[model samples]
Target: MASEGGFFSAVWETIKTIFWALIIAGVFRTVFYQPFWIPSGSMKDTLLIGDFLFVNKMAYGYSYASCPSIRLQRFGIDVDAQDICFFLDGDNTRLFGDEPERGDVVVFRHPSTGQDYIKRLVGLPGETVQMIDGVLHINGEPVQLEDGGQFVETYERQGPEGRPPRCENGAVGPGADCIKSRQIETLPGGSSHSILNIGDYRGADDTGVFNVPEGHYFMMGDNRDNSLDSRFPASAGGVGYVPFENLIGRADRIMFSSAGRSMLFFWTWRSDRYFKAIE
Candidate 1:
Protein backbone atom coordinates (compact mmCIF):
# COMPACT_ATOMS: atom_id res chain seq x y z
CA MET A 1 0.00 0.00 0.00
CA ALA A 2 2.89 2.42 0.74
CA SER A 3 4.56 1.57 -2.56
CA GLU A 4 1.30 2.28 -4.43
CA GLY A 5 0.98 5.65 -2.67
CA GLY A 6 4.57 6.53 -3.51
CA PHE A 7 4.00 5.80 -7.23
CA PHE A 8 0.93 8.05 -7.28
CA SER A 9 2.82 10.88 -5.54
CA ALA A 10 5.65 10.69 -8.11
CA VAL A 11 3.18 10.83 -10.93
CA TRP A 12 1.47 13.86 -9.38
CA GLU A 13 4.81 15.60 -8.94
CA THR A 14 5.70 15.02 -12.57
CA ILE A 15 2.37 16.43 -13.67
CA LYS A 16 2.82 19.50 -11.48
CA THR A 17 6.28 20.14 -12.92
CA ILE A 18 4.99 19.93 -16.48
CA PHE A 19 2.07 22.23 -15.65
CA TRP A 20 4.36 24.89 -14.23
CA ALA A 21 6.77 24.56 -17.10
CA LEU A 22 3.97 25.14 -19.59
CA ILE A 23 2.77 28.15 -17.65
CA ILE A 24 6.24 29.65 -17.64
CA ALA A 25 6.66 29.03 -21.36
CA GLY A 26 3.29 30.58 -22.08
CA VAL A 27 4.11 33.67 -20.08
CA PHE A 28 7.47 34.03 -21.77
CA ARG A 29 5.94 33.76 -25.21
CA THR A 30 3.16 36.21 -24.41
CA VAL A 31 5.32 38.83 -22.74
CA PHE A 32 8.84 38.63 -24.09
CA TYR A 33 9.25 36.82 -27.39
CA GLN A 34 7.16 34.84 -29.85
CA PRO A 35 8.45 32.20 -32.19
CA PHE A 36 7.80 32.83 -35.93
CA TRP A 37 8.38 30.42 -38.72
CA ILE A 38 8.74 31.63 -42.28
CA PRO A 39 6.32 29.59 -44.37
CA SER A 40 6.43 31.73 -47.50
CA GLY A 41 9.07 33.30 -49.72
CA SER A 42 7.61 36.77 -49.89
CA MET A 43 10.61 38.08 -47.96
CA LYS A 44 12.93 35.95 -50.15
CA ASP A 45 16.66 36.51 -49.70
CA THR A 46 16.00 38.72 -46.69
CA LEU A 47 14.05 35.88 -45.04
CA LEU A 48 13.64 32.53 -46.70
CA ILE A 49 11.06 29.86 -46.12
CA GLY A 50 11.75 27.63 -43.07
CA ASP A 51 13.61 30.39 -41.23
CA PHE A 52 12.71 30.22 -37.54
CA LEU A 53 13.05 33.30 -35.41
CA PHE A 54 11.77 34.79 -32.17
CA VAL A 55 10.04 38.13 -32.51
CA ASN A 56 10.82 40.72 -29.82
CA LYS A 57 7.39 41.47 -28.45
CA MET A 58 8.59 44.41 -26.41
CA ALA A 59 9.69 46.32 -29.47
CA TYR A 60 6.30 47.86 -30.04
CA GLY A 61 4.86 47.21 -26.57
CA TYR A 62 1.83 45.00 -25.95
CA SER A 63 -1.44 44.76 -27.80
CA TYR A 64 -4.26 42.31 -28.33
CA ALA A 65 -2.31 41.03 -31.32
CA SER A 66 0.53 40.05 -29.01
CA CYS A 67 -1.58 37.23 -27.70
CA PRO A 68 -0.70 33.96 -29.38
CA SER A 69 -3.20 32.18 -31.60
CA ILE A 70 -3.08 28.44 -31.69
CA ARG A 71 -4.82 26.56 -34.53
CA LEU A 72 -4.52 22.87 -35.12
CA GLN A 73 -7.14 21.56 -37.49
CA ARG A 74 -6.10 17.97 -36.82
CA PHE A 75 -6.85 18.44 -33.13
CA GLY A 76 -9.97 20.59 -33.68
CA ILE A 77 -8.31 23.40 -31.71
CA ASP A 78 -8.71 26.93 -32.98
CA VAL A 79 -7.99 29.73 -30.57
CA ASP A 80 -7.39 33.16 -32.02
CA ALA A 81 -5.74 36.11 -30.32
CA GLN A 82 -9.06 37.91 -30.44
CA ASP A 83 -10.70 34.90 -28.85
CA ILE A 84 -8.29 35.03 -25.96
CA CYS A 85 -8.32 38.82 -25.57
CA PHE A 86 -11.52 39.92 -27.21
CA PHE A 87 -12.04 42.73 -24.73
CA LEU A 88 -8.77 44.25 -25.83
CA ASP A 89 -10.00 44.53 -29.40
CA GLY A 90 -11.60 47.63 -31.08
CA ASP A 91 -9.49 49.98 -28.92
CA ASN A 92 -6.78 50.32 -31.60
CA THR A 93 -4.35 51.31 -28.89
CA ARG A 94 -1.30 49.54 -27.55
CA LEU A 95 0.04 49.59 -24.04
CA PHE A 96 3.43 51.27 -23.75
CA GLY A 97 3.46 51.59 -27.52
CA ASP A 98 6.36 52.78 -29.62
CA GLU A 99 6.16 53.61 -33.28
CA PRO A 100 7.80 51.20 -35.68
CA GLU A 101 10.50 52.52 -37.97
CA ARG A 102 10.73 52.17 -41.71
CA GLY A 103 12.61 49.07 -42.88
CA ASP A 104 12.08 47.14 -39.67
CA VAL A 105 10.94 43.59 -40.41
CA VAL A 106 7.74 43.01 -38.50
CA VAL A 107 5.15 40.34 -37.82
CA PHE A 108 1.60 41.52 -37.45
CA ARG A 109 -1.93 40.17 -37.54
CA HIS A 110 -3.96 40.63 -40.69
CA PRO A 111 -6.71 43.10 -39.90
CA SER A 112 -9.39 41.18 -41.73
CA THR A 113 -8.25 37.57 -41.58
CA GLY A 114 -6.58 37.60 -38.16
CA GLN A 115 -3.75 35.58 -39.68
CA ASP A 116 -0.14 36.49 -38.92
CA TYR A 117 2.00 38.10 -41.61
CA ILE A 118 5.62 39.18 -41.74
CA LYS A 119 6.78 42.05 -43.92
CA ARG A 120 9.13 44.99 -43.98
CA LEU A 121 7.66 48.19 -42.63
CA VAL A 122 8.16 50.55 -45.54
CA GLY A 123 5.70 53.32 -44.97
CA LEU A 124 4.93 55.02 -41.66
CA PRO A 125 1.77 56.83 -40.68
CA GLY A 126 0.57 59.48 -43.12
CA GLU A 127 3.22 58.73 -45.69
CA THR A 128 2.69 58.40 -49.43
CA VAL A 129 4.00 55.15 -50.82
CA GLN A 130 4.12 54.09 -54.43
CA MET A 131 5.92 51.67 -56.66
CA ILE A 132 6.75 53.31 -59.96
CA ASP A 133 8.36 51.11 -62.57
CA GLY A 134 9.62 48.60 -60.07
CA VAL A 135 11.18 51.32 -57.90
CA LEU A 136 9.80 52.20 -54.50
CA HIS A 137 8.92 55.83 -53.91
CA ILE A 138 8.22 57.43 -50.52
CA ASN A 139 6.44 60.76 -50.52
CA GLY A 140 7.05 60.92 -54.27
CA GLU A 141 10.82 60.51 -53.87
CA PRO A 142 12.24 57.25 -55.11
CA VAL A 143 14.37 55.29 -52.69
CA GLN A 144 17.96 54.59 -53.71
CA LEU A 145 18.54 51.32 -55.50
CA GLU A 146 21.85 49.82 -56.59
CA ASP A 147 22.63 46.76 -58.56
CA GLY A 148 23.18 43.71 -56.33
CA GLY A 149 24.07 41.25 -59.05
CA GLN A 150 21.75 38.24 -59.19
CA PHE A 151 20.10 35.92 -56.72
CA VAL A 152 20.25 32.29 -57.80
CA GLU A 153 18.65 29.17 -56.41
CA THR A 154 17.64 25.68 -57.36
CA TYR A 155 14.60 25.43 -59.64
CA GLU A 156 12.90 22.86 -57.53
CA ARG A 157 10.31 22.58 -54.82
CA GLN A 158 11.26 24.44 -51.62
CA GLY A 159 10.19 24.22 -48.00
CA PRO A 160 7.24 22.20 -46.76
CA GLU A 161 4.80 23.72 -49.21
CA GLY A 162 6.76 22.32 -52.14
CA ARG A 163 6.40 25.58 -54.01
CA PRO A 164 8.76 26.49 -56.80
CA PRO A 165 10.33 29.91 -56.98
CA ARG A 166 9.26 32.39 -59.65
CA CYS A 167 12.41 33.14 -61.54
CA GLU A 168 13.17 36.14 -63.68
CA ASN A 169 14.95 33.73 -65.94
CA GLY A 170 11.61 32.01 -66.64
CA ALA A 171 10.77 28.32 -66.29
CA VAL A 172 13.62 25.89 -65.91
CA GLY A 173 13.85 22.18 -65.31
CA PRO A 174 14.16 20.88 -61.78
CA GLY A 175 17.65 21.09 -60.26
CA ALA A 176 18.53 23.82 -62.79
CA ASP A 177 19.49 27.33 -61.79
CA CYS A 178 16.65 29.71 -61.00
CA ILE A 179 17.63 33.35 -60.99
CA LYS A 180 16.21 36.73 -60.09
CA SER A 181 17.55 40.27 -60.20
CA ARG A 182 18.85 41.53 -56.89
CA GLN A 183 19.16 45.13 -55.77
CA ILE A 184 20.22 46.93 -52.61
CA GLU A 185 17.47 49.35 -51.66
CA THR A 186 18.19 52.18 -49.27
CA LEU A 187 15.28 53.76 -47.45
CA PRO A 188 15.00 57.43 -46.56
CA GLY A 189 16.52 57.00 -43.10
CA GLY A 190 19.52 55.14 -44.55
CA SER A 191 18.23 51.67 -43.75
CA SER A 192 19.23 49.38 -46.61
CA HIS A 193 18.27 45.82 -47.47
CA SER A 194 18.30 43.44 -50.41
CA ILE A 195 15.32 43.34 -52.72
CA LEU A 196 14.66 40.80 -55.41
CA ASN A 197 13.01 41.61 -58.69
CA ILE A 198 11.60 38.81 -60.76
CA GLY A 199 10.45 41.08 -63.56
CA ASP A 200 9.71 44.66 -64.45
CA TYR A 201 6.20 44.18 -65.85
CA ARG A 202 4.54 42.79 -62.74
CA GLY A 203 1.38 44.58 -61.62
CA ALA A 204 2.75 45.56 -58.22
CA ASP A 205 5.78 47.17 -59.88
CA ASP A 206 3.60 50.11 -60.83
CA THR A 207 0.90 51.13 -58.40
CA GLY A 208 -1.08 54.18 -57.47
CA VAL A 209 0.13 56.29 -54.56
CA PHE A 210 -1.06 54.93 -51.23
CA ASN A 211 -1.58 57.46 -48.46
CA VAL A 212 -0.99 55.62 -45.20
CA PRO A 213 -3.59 56.40 -42.58
CA GLU A 214 -2.84 58.05 -39.23
CA GLY A 215 -2.40 54.87 -37.20
CA HIS A 216 -1.82 52.46 -40.04
CA TYR A 217 1.34 51.43 -41.92
CA PHE A 218 2.18 50.26 -45.41
CA MET A 219 4.12 47.04 -45.56
CA MET A 220 5.85 45.34 -48.48
CA GLY A 221 7.78 42.20 -48.98
CA ASP A 222 11.43 42.35 -50.03
CA ASN A 223 10.57 40.22 -53.01
CA ARG A 224 8.69 43.02 -54.66
CA ASP A 225 7.28 41.20 -57.63
CA ASN A 226 6.08 38.22 -55.65
CA SER A 227 4.59 39.87 -52.56
CA LEU A 228 0.90 40.56 -52.21
CA ASP A 229 1.11 43.46 -49.82
CA SER A 230 -0.39 46.91 -49.41
CA ARG A 231 -0.36 47.29 -53.17
CA PHE A 232 -3.37 44.97 -53.18
CA PRO A 233 -6.39 45.58 -51.03
CA ALA A 234 -7.57 43.18 -48.33
CA SER A 235 -10.67 42.52 -50.42
CA ALA A 236 -8.37 41.39 -53.20
CA GLY A 237 -6.62 38.81 -51.02
CA GLY A 238 -3.79 41.05 -49.87
CA VAL A 239 -3.16 42.79 -46.60
CA GLY A 240 -4.15 46.43 -46.81
CA TYR A 241 -2.91 49.16 -44.50
CA VAL A 242 -2.23 47.31 -41.28
CA PRO A 243 -3.37 49.01 -38.11
CA PHE A 244 -0.86 49.89 -35.39
CA GLU A 245 -2.63 47.75 -32.84
CA ASN A 246 -2.32 44.78 -35.17
CA LEU A 247 1.44 44.90 -34.80
CA ILE A 248 2.75 41.90 -32.93
CA GLY A 249 6.55 42.19 -32.76
CA ARG A 250 9.78 42.85 -34.62
CA ALA A 251 11.84 39.98 -35.92
CA ASP A 252 15.51 40.58 -35.21
CA ARG A 253 17.26 37.38 -36.17
CA ILE A 254 16.93 33.87 -37.40
CA MET A 255 17.52 31.23 -34.73
CA PHE A 256 17.26 28.25 -37.04
CA SER A 257 16.52 27.41 -40.67
CA SER A 258 15.84 24.39 -42.78
CA ALA A 259 15.50 23.99 -46.53
CA GLY A 260 13.66 20.71 -46.44
CA ARG A 261 9.99 20.03 -45.86
CA SER A 262 10.54 18.95 -42.27
CA MET A 263 12.74 20.44 -39.58
CA LEU A 264 13.43 16.95 -38.33
CA PHE A 265 15.42 16.30 -41.48
CA PHE A 266 18.85 17.01 -40.05
CA TRP A 267 20.50 16.89 -43.46
CA THR A 268 18.39 19.83 -44.69
CA TRP A 269 19.32 22.16 -41.87
CA ARG A 270 21.09 25.36 -42.90
CA SER A 271 24.12 25.75 -40.68
CA ASP A 272 25.00 29.14 -42.14
CA ARG A 273 21.64 30.62 -41.21
CA TYR A 274 21.77 29.55 -37.57
CA PHE A 275 21.73 32.62 -35.31
CA LYS A 276 21.91 34.83 -38.38
CA ALA A 277 20.80 38.40 -37.85
CA ILE A 278 17.89 39.63 -39.95
CA GLU A 279 18.74 42.75 -41.91
Candidate 2:
Protein backbone atom coordinates (compact mmCIF):
# COMPACT_ATOMS: atom_id res chain seq x y z
CA MET A 1 0.00 0.00 0.00
CA ALA A 2 2.82 2.44 0.80
CA SER A 3 4.55 1.77 -2.55
CA GLU A 4 1.34 2.34 -4.48
CA GLY A 5 0.68 5.61 -2.66
CA GLY A 6 4.20 6.85 -3.51
CA PHE A 7 3.70 6.14 -7.21
CA PHE A 8 0.43 8.01 -7.21
CA SER A 9 1.99 10.98 -5.43
CA ALA A 10 4.75 11.19 -8.05
CA VAL A 11 2.23 11.15 -10.86
CA TRP A 12 0.14 13.82 -9.21
CA GLU A 13 3.14 16.07 -8.77
CA THR A 14 4.06 15.63 -12.42
CA ILE A 15 0.57 16.61 -13.47
CA LYS A 16 0.61 19.70 -11.29
CA THR A 17 3.94 20.80 -12.74
CA ILE A 18 2.68 20.36 -16.27
CA PHE A 19 -0.46 22.30 -15.51
CA TRP A 20 1.45 25.24 -14.09
CA ALA A 21 3.88 25.20 -17.01
CA LEU A 22 1.05 25.38 -19.48
CA ILE A 23 -0.52 28.24 -17.65
CA ILE A 24 2.70 30.22 -17.66
CA ALA A 25 3.27 29.54 -21.33
CA GLY A 26 -0.26 30.57 -22.11
CA VAL A 27 0.22 33.82 -20.29
CA PHE A 28 3.45 34.52 -22.11
CA ARG A 29 1.95 33.70 -25.50
CA THR A 30 -1.01 35.93 -24.83
CA VAL A 31 0.98 38.84 -23.49
CA PHE A 32 4.31 38.92 -25.27
CA TYR A 33 4.64 36.80 -28.42
CA GLN A 34 2.52 34.60 -30.63
CA PRO A 35 3.96 31.90 -32.84
CA PHE A 36 2.70 31.41 -36.37
CA TRP A 37 3.47 28.70 -38.89
CA ILE A 38 3.77 29.59 -42.52
CA PRO A 39 1.81 27.11 -44.58
CA SER A 40 1.70 28.93 -47.92
CA GLY A 41 4.19 30.58 -50.25
CA SER A 42 2.35 33.85 -50.58
CA MET A 43 5.21 35.77 -48.97
CA LYS A 44 7.74 33.58 -50.81
CA ASP A 45 11.44 34.35 -50.95
CA THR A 46 11.05 36.62 -47.91
CA LEU A 47 9.14 33.98 -45.96
CA LEU A 48 9.08 30.45 -47.25
CA ILE A 49 6.61 27.65 -46.75
CA GLY A 50 7.22 25.72 -43.51
CA ASP A 51 8.77 28.74 -41.88
CA PHE A 52 7.88 29.32 -38.24
CA LEU A 53 8.08 32.75 -36.69
CA PHE A 54 6.69 34.75 -33.81
CA VAL A 55 4.55 37.78 -34.23
CA ASN A 56 5.37 40.29 -31.48
CA LYS A 57 2.05 40.55 -29.72
CA MET A 58 3.12 43.61 -27.81
CA ALA A 59 4.50 45.38 -30.84
CA TYR A 60 1.06 46.81 -31.52
CA GLY A 61 -0.57 46.63 -28.12
CA TYR A 62 -3.27 44.11 -27.17
CA SER A 63 -6.59 43.17 -28.65
CA TYR A 64 -9.17 40.65 -27.58
CA ALA A 65 -8.05 38.54 -30.52
CA SER A 66 -4.63 38.40 -28.91
CA CYS A 67 -6.01 38.01 -25.44
CA PRO A 68 -5.65 34.25 -25.51
CA SER A 69 -8.65 33.83 -27.78
CA ILE A 70 -7.09 33.19 -31.22
CA ARG A 71 -6.48 29.65 -30.06
CA LEU A 72 -8.88 29.51 -27.15
CA GLN A 73 -11.17 27.16 -28.98
CA ARG A 74 -8.47 24.52 -28.78
CA PHE A 75 -8.31 24.94 -25.00
CA GLY A 76 -12.07 24.37 -24.74
CA ILE A 77 -12.74 28.10 -24.57
CA ASP A 78 -14.82 28.98 -27.61
CA VAL A 79 -14.31 32.18 -29.59
CA ASP A 80 -17.03 33.22 -31.96
CA ALA A 81 -16.21 34.08 -35.53
CA GLN A 82 -18.73 36.87 -35.43
CA ASP A 83 -17.01 38.62 -32.53
CA ILE A 84 -13.65 38.32 -34.23
CA CYS A 85 -15.16 39.77 -37.37
CA PHE A 86 -16.81 42.67 -35.59
CA PHE A 87 -13.80 43.53 -33.42
CA LEU A 88 -10.80 42.60 -35.56
CA ASP A 89 -11.87 42.67 -39.17
CA GLY A 90 -12.06 46.35 -39.94
CA ASP A 91 -12.10 49.79 -38.30
CA ASN A 92 -13.21 48.23 -35.05
CA THR A 93 -9.72 47.22 -33.91
CA ARG A 94 -8.48 49.02 -30.81
CA LEU A 95 -4.88 49.13 -29.68
CA PHE A 96 -2.50 51.01 -27.41
CA GLY A 97 0.62 50.20 -29.39
CA ASP A 98 2.20 52.37 -32.01
CA GLU A 99 0.34 53.05 -35.21
CA PRO A 100 1.40 50.95 -38.18
CA GLU A 101 4.09 52.41 -40.40
CA ARG A 102 4.85 51.77 -44.05
CA GLY A 103 7.01 48.70 -44.80
CA ASP A 104 6.07 46.70 -41.73
CA VAL A 105 5.33 43.05 -42.43
CA VAL A 106 1.96 42.63 -40.75
CA VAL A 107 -0.26 39.72 -39.81
CA PHE A 108 -3.97 40.26 -39.52
CA ARG A 109 -7.42 38.69 -39.76
CA HIS A 110 -8.78 38.56 -43.26
CA PRO A 111 -11.85 40.80 -43.37
CA SER A 112 -14.10 38.63 -45.47
CA THR A 113 -12.75 35.17 -44.72
CA GLY A 114 -11.91 35.67 -41.04
CA GLN A 115 -8.64 33.86 -41.63
CA ASP A 116 -5.24 35.26 -40.75
CA TYR A 117 -2.95 36.64 -43.43
CA ILE A 118 0.59 37.97 -43.50
CA LYS A 119 1.78 40.59 -45.99
CA ARG A 120 3.89 43.71 -46.39
CA LEU A 121 2.35 47.08 -45.87
CA VAL A 122 2.74 48.84 -49.20
CA GLY A 123 0.30 51.71 -48.97
CA LEU A 124 -0.50 53.73 -45.88
CA PRO A 125 -3.78 55.27 -44.95
CA GLY A 126 -4.83 57.97 -47.40
CA GLU A 127 -2.17 57.09 -49.94
CA THR A 128 -2.91 56.59 -53.61
CA VAL A 129 -1.35 53.33 -54.75
CA GLN A 130 -1.11 51.90 -58.23
CA MET A 131 1.02 49.54 -60.25
CA ILE A 132 2.13 50.52 -63.76
CA ASP A 133 3.84 47.94 -65.97
CA GLY A 134 5.23 46.23 -62.87
CA VAL A 135 6.36 49.44 -61.25
CA LEU A 136 4.91 50.44 -57.91
CA HIS A 137 3.43 53.88 -58.14
CA ILE A 138 2.57 55.78 -54.97
CA ASN A 139 0.52 58.90 -55.24
CA GLY A 140 1.17 59.16 -58.99
CA GLU A 141 4.93 58.84 -58.48
CA PRO A 142 6.94 55.66 -59.06
CA VAL A 143 9.07 54.37 -56.22
CA GLN A 144 12.70 53.53 -56.97
CA LEU A 145 13.32 50.16 -58.57
CA GLU A 146 16.67 48.41 -58.69
CA ASP A 147 17.89 45.30 -60.46
CA GLY A 148 17.97 42.69 -57.67
CA GLY A 149 19.71 40.10 -59.86
CA GLN A 150 18.48 36.75 -61.09
CA PHE A 151 19.11 33.20 -60.06
CA VAL A 152 17.92 29.78 -61.19
CA GLU A 153 15.77 28.12 -58.57
CA THR A 154 15.69 24.37 -58.11
CA TYR A 155 12.32 23.26 -56.78
CA GLU A 156 11.90 20.36 -54.42
CA ARG A 157 8.22 19.94 -55.31
CA GLN A 158 6.35 19.98 -58.58
CA GLY A 159 4.70 23.36 -59.08
CA PRO A 160 2.69 24.83 -61.94
CA GLU A 161 3.58 23.75 -65.49
CA GLY A 162 5.47 20.70 -64.18
CA ARG A 163 8.24 22.86 -62.78
CA PRO A 164 9.71 21.86 -59.49
CA PRO A 165 9.70 25.55 -58.49
CA ARG A 166 6.52 27.30 -59.51
CA CYS A 167 7.06 30.97 -60.25
CA GLU A 168 4.72 33.73 -61.29
CA ASN A 169 5.40 32.70 -64.87
CA GLY A 170 3.37 29.55 -64.33
CA ALA A 171 5.87 26.96 -63.13
CA VAL A 172 9.15 26.21 -64.91
CA GLY A 173 11.97 25.44 -62.59
CA PRO A 174 15.15 23.31 -62.23
CA GLY A 175 15.37 22.17 -65.86
CA ALA A 176 15.89 24.04 -69.11
CA ASP A 177 13.43 26.98 -69.61
CA CYS A 178 12.99 28.43 -66.11
CA ILE A 179 11.89 32.00 -65.54
CA LYS A 180 14.90 34.02 -64.38
CA SER A 181 13.64 37.59 -64.04
CA ARG A 182 13.30 39.28 -60.65
CA GLN A 183 13.85 42.72 -59.11
CA ILE A 184 14.28 44.61 -55.85
CA GLU A 185 11.44 46.97 -55.00
CA THR A 186 12.01 49.87 -52.61
CA LEU A 187 8.94 51.20 -50.87
CA PRO A 188 8.45 54.96 -50.70
CA GLY A 189 9.20 54.94 -46.98
CA GLY A 190 12.73 53.61 -47.76
CA SER A 191 12.38 49.89 -47.22
CA SER A 192 13.75 47.43 -49.77
CA HIS A 193 12.45 43.96 -50.62
CA SER A 194 12.74 41.54 -53.52
CA ILE A 195 10.01 40.76 -56.02
CA LEU A 196 9.67 38.10 -58.72
CA ASN A 197 7.90 38.53 -62.04
CA ILE A 198 7.15 35.32 -63.85
CA GLY A 199 6.80 36.10 -67.58
CA ASP A 200 3.04 35.68 -67.18
CA TYR A 201 1.23 39.03 -67.31
CA ARG A 202 -1.27 38.99 -64.49
CA GLY A 203 -3.27 42.22 -64.29
CA ALA A 204 -1.72 42.92 -60.85
CA ASP A 205 1.38 44.07 -62.71
CA ASP A 206 -0.56 46.91 -64.30
CA THR A 207 -3.39 48.03 -62.10
CA GLY A 208 -5.23 51.32 -61.95
CA VAL A 209 -4.96 53.79 -59.09
CA PHE A 210 -6.28 52.72 -55.70
CA ASN A 211 -7.02 55.55 -53.34
CA VAL A 212 -6.46 54.04 -49.90
CA PRO A 213 -9.26 55.42 -47.80
CA GLU A 214 -8.76 56.74 -44.32
CA GLY A 215 -8.06 54.09 -41.64
CA HIS A 216 -7.21 51.49 -44.25
CA TYR A 217 -3.97 50.12 -45.68
CA PHE A 218 -2.70 48.39 -48.80
CA MET A 219 -0.92 45.08 -48.70
CA MET A 220 1.01 42.99 -51.21
CA GLY A 221 3.18 39.94 -51.43
CA ASP A 222 6.78 39.99 -52.53
CA ASN A 223 5.97 37.30 -55.10
CA ARG A 224 4.52 39.98 -57.35
CA ASP A 225 2.42 38.53 -60.16
CA ASN A 226 1.55 35.39 -58.24
CA SER A 227 0.13 37.06 -55.15
CA LEU A 228 -3.51 37.86 -54.50
CA ASP A 229 -2.97 41.17 -52.81
CA SER A 230 -4.52 44.60 -52.61
CA ARG A 231 -3.90 44.98 -56.31
CA PHE A 232 -6.80 42.61 -56.91
CA PRO A 233 -10.23 43.63 -55.71
CA ALA A 234 -11.66 41.61 -52.81
CA SER A 235 -14.46 40.46 -55.11
CA ALA A 236 -11.79 38.89 -57.28
CA GLY A 237 -10.43 36.63 -54.52
CA GLY A 238 -7.75 38.98 -53.21
CA VAL A 239 -7.25 40.63 -49.81
CA GLY A 240 -8.15 44.10 -50.80
CA TYR A 241 -7.44 47.18 -48.66
CA VAL A 242 -6.81 46.01 -45.11
CA PRO A 243 -8.16 48.15 -42.34
CA PHE A 244 -6.02 49.43 -39.46
CA GLU A 245 -8.07 47.60 -36.87
CA ASN A 246 -7.45 44.34 -38.68
CA LEU A 247 -3.70 44.67 -38.21
CA ILE A 248 -2.34 42.18 -35.71
CA GLY A 249 1.38 42.66 -35.35
CA ARG A 250 4.53 42.76 -37.42
CA ALA A 251 6.52 39.63 -38.19
CA ASP A 252 9.93 40.37 -36.75
CA ARG A 253 12.04 37.38 -37.77
CA ILE A 254 12.11 33.76 -38.81
CA MET A 255 12.63 31.34 -35.93
CA PHE A 256 13.40 28.52 -38.34
CA SER A 257 12.27 26.88 -41.57
CA SER A 258 11.73 23.43 -43.01
CA ALA A 259 11.16 22.24 -46.55
CA GLY A 260 7.90 20.43 -45.77
CA ARG A 261 9.96 17.35 -45.04
CA SER A 262 9.45 15.34 -41.91
CA MET A 263 10.86 17.02 -38.83
CA LEU A 264 12.81 13.83 -38.37
CA PHE A 265 14.60 14.67 -41.62
CA PHE A 266 16.89 17.09 -39.85
CA TRP A 267 18.90 17.52 -43.03
CA THR A 268 15.93 19.21 -44.69
CA TRP A 269 16.03 22.10 -42.25
CA ARG A 270 17.08 25.49 -43.60
CA SER A 271 19.38 26.32 -40.74
CA ASP A 272 20.54 29.55 -42.29
CA ARG A 273 17.09 31.04 -41.86
CA TYR A 274 17.19 30.57 -38.11
CA PHE A 275 16.61 33.91 -36.40
CA LYS A 276 16.86 35.77 -39.71
CA ALA A 277 15.53 39.25 -39.19
CA ILE A 278 12.72 40.44 -41.43
CA GLU A 279 13.64 43.22 -43.83
The most accurate candidate by TM-score is: 1
Deviation (Å) of 136 in candidate 1: 0.7
Model 2 scores what on Cα lDDT? 0.74
Worst 10 residues of 2 by lDDT: 155-164
Kindly list the per-residue Cα lDDT of model 2 for residues 1-279, writing each as its tens digit. 999999999999999999999999988976788788776666767887767899987777766556544446667876644464445433455668577878888988676775778988989888899888888899999988888777355555632222255554455535545455668888876899877766555677787889998878999988776678888777888889887666667899998887644433557778789899988
- Candidate 2, after superposition: displacement of residue 64 in Å? 2.9
The regions of model 1 sitting more than 4 angstroms off are 200-202
Q: Who wins the lDDT comparison?
A: 1
lDDT of each: 0.93, 0.74
> What is the clash count for each candidate, in the order shown?
0, 1
Clashing pairs in 1: none
How do the residues 87-159 of candidate 1 rate in per-residue lDDT, one tens digit apiece?
A: 8788789999999999999999988899999999999998999988999999999999999999999998888
